[model samples]
Structures are given as structure tokens and as C-alpha cells.
Target: MGESGAYRRLPVAERRRQLLVAALDLFSHRPPEQVSIDDIASAAGASRPLVYRYFPGGRQQIYEAALRSAAEQLTACFTEPPAGTPTQRLRNALDRYLAFVADHDAGFSALVRGGCVTETSRTTAIIDEVRRAAAEQVFVHLGVPAPGLMLRMAVRSWIAAVETVSLIWLDEGRQPPADQLRDWLIDHFVAVLTATAAGDPQSSEVLSGFLAAVEGQPRSVR
Candidate 1:
């Protein structure tokens, strides 16, 4: 917190963390582009030089840090599953997902916009990982093998669907109707799994193939 001729007292990690906290607060009030390093440094109660020392690249660094913070918070929501059926678990995930967006309204909005601007944008990889993990959870819970191209496509598609739904809701400036979203997901899940569970051999076959793709196996779509 103090400084001398050539060195400051705060550790590098702590300074970066403080910078991110400051950036997140600023982002909540306005878009990322509207914010400046001075704003962040001012909010952080640190000198501009000190802020630069922690994040020399400036805005981009702060933006990425803000995103990382959001991702970490969202991931924390999924850390545990309460006692419930598969449907309950899916509902719980959706509930938590929406709650996360609502809780960090500004930061989540910025992340969505920032990520779309470039494929190389910050948080893309983190989002991808989150989606993949969610998909895996869905398939695995249904007792599917989750292998191959179908697996890949299914999980990716599923995750995209969920994210897209959430994004649309956010864009509309409405919290995704949690009950409605949960019911919809549950219905889609039941349709597939129930068909497979029934004696419908074709549905079972298709599901098995999809699950295989999810498990990293290759499958011909045709």
C-alpha cells in the first residue's frame, strides 16, 4: 500500500486483483469503452503509475480481468448439486445461471458484447469451457455414453441454445423467466431421454450416436 523510490509495497497479485475489482465496478455503470484507466485507478484508490505497473496494457487488461472475475463467480454457482432428480438439477443450473447474470448485470452485459466483437476476444475460451461442461453434465446425467461427433455437436448445440436463450433475455432487458426456461429445458430433455428409455429403437439409436459424439467419437450425420 506504500511506495518507495523504486518499489511499491503491494504485491503484484494483490494489485491486479484490486484493479479488477475497480474495473468491475466501473463496468457496471457504463460500457467498457466508456471507462478509462484513470477511472479504474481512481476507483481503486491507487496512483495511475501504480495501476499501470499492475496492468500495463491498460483497458484490455482490465476488461479481461473483469471478465475473468465474472466467469469465476458464475462457475462458483455450479459448484454443488442439491438433492434432486435430473430435471431438478437442470432447473437448478438454469436458476443459478440467470441469478448470476442478474447479480452482475453490468459485467455480464459487457462480457457478452466484448466476446462477440472478436473471436479472439477475452472470455471466449472461458465461455466455451463453461458451455462444454454444462453439456457434459446434461448428457452424463441422462446416462448417455456421450462420445463422437454427435457428442461434440450435441453438447455444443445444447450449450449454445442455453446461452443464446439467456443472451436474448438479457438483450430484452428482462431476466430470463426462470420457471419458463426450466420447464422448456426439462421438456426437451425428457423428450429425448424418454424416447430412448422407451422401446423406440430408432430414438434409442439416434440418442446413442449423439451421446457417442459427446464422448468424443466420430459420427456421420447422414
Candidate 2:
């Protein structure tokens, strides 16, 4: 079959997915503002008009979609089965999270840095939700049904550190290896919670629980 005929035979949903994957791949390499509709079309093996047909709002619309997809994947990084100790679960989660950073270097950097040229209210909310969801996941790992003020602040502070370190890791050429970074971040969490536990009884209890659980697990990844 001819090239255009082959494209025409693709299901609508499948074509849109192809465009999204292509767009995300481009976005993963460069800042979103640097990518163009023509670039996306060529990457997806589709024409500019065909790209527009699926995304009438053009690059901005596709960017938002790609951002949404990235957000979903990023948020999922912290979720794991409740089968391991707190630190063990966190180790698994950080492995996945850092892997995403390694894969989507530019995209992760752009999202963390903020003020993307295509920034819109919707995109901002999506990005914010990623942070919120990540924090919630940490709380879940702590087995906290309702976190107190100090506990919330402590977790959020560590969450912010994770983003900063990830950006720095990219800026520094991903030095120290991902497992090292992941272990360091988990250690920082333990330390932060420990400090918070000094003043906050809730953090005290959760940290105690986490420490007791950590005793039975492998110290770190092999």
C-alpha cells in the first residue's frame, strides 16, 4: 500500500496516539517552545495539515496533551504495592522516578524550572497536581491517614528537595549514578522526618514505625 493510504487506514485514536508519542519524544529532548508543528508532523510521519486535523489548537494543544501524559507518568512514579518496608517502597519508587528523569531529561527540567512558553492555567494545574500527588504518595508510604501541619511541611520540604536534586543531577550530567541519587534522597527523607519528629509527635510516631520496618529489609539495592 502507498504511504498516505497506509496512514489513512490507521484508526483515529491510534493516529492521535502516534502523534502524541512523537510529540512527547521531541519534547523529551528539547524544551517545548523549541518544538514546532512541522517538526511533530515529520516525526510522526504525518503532514502538517493532518497534525492540525487532530489538534486544531496546534502545537499548544498538543503540548498540553503531552504535558498531561508526562504528568500521569511522573505521578505514577511514587505508587508501589504496599508490600515492602517504608524505605524499601521508597527505594522502588525513586528508582522509577529517576529513570523517568534519565529518559525525559529536558522535559523534566522544563517542568521543574517553570514558565514554559506554552504555559497556560491548565498546564500549570497539571504540573501542580504532580507535586501534590507525589506528596500524597509519600504520606501513603508513611501510613499516615491524616498528616499534621509539621508532618505535611516536612514531607513537602523533602519533595521540593527531590525536584531540586533531580534538576541538579541533570545539570551535572546525571553524575553519582541513579541508584546513588535515589538512596541519597531516601536518606534525606529519613533525616527530615527524624528532625520533624523532634518537634512533632505525629512525625515521631511515623518515623518510629518506618525505622522499625526498615530493620527487616535489605539495606539497599544490590
Task: Choose the strongest candidate by TM-score.
Answer: 2
Best by lDDT: 2
Clashes of each: 18, 0
* CA deviation > 4 Å runs, candidate 1: 1-11, 113-122, 143-145, 191-222
Q: Assess every candidate by TM-score.
A: 0.70, 0.94
Candidate 1 scores a C-alpha RMSD against the true structure in Å of 7.2
The sequence of per-residue lDDT tens digits that candidate 1 reaches over residues 1-222 is: 444544356777877787788888787656677788889888988878887777787777767767777777776665544344445556777778877766666656666655333225345887666666666665555445534554445445666666667667777776447677667865665454444445555446556644564455544322
TM-score of 1: 0.70
The lowest-lDDT stretch of 10 consecutive residues in candidate 1 is 113-122
Candidate 1 positional error at 183, Å:
3.0
Question: What's the true lDDT of residue 32 in model 1?
Answer: 70
Every candidate's lDDT: 0.64, 0.89
Model 2: ten consecutive residues of lowest lDDT: 213-222
Total backbone clashes of model 1?
Answer: 18
Candidate 1 whole-model C-alpha lDDT, 0 to 1: 0.64
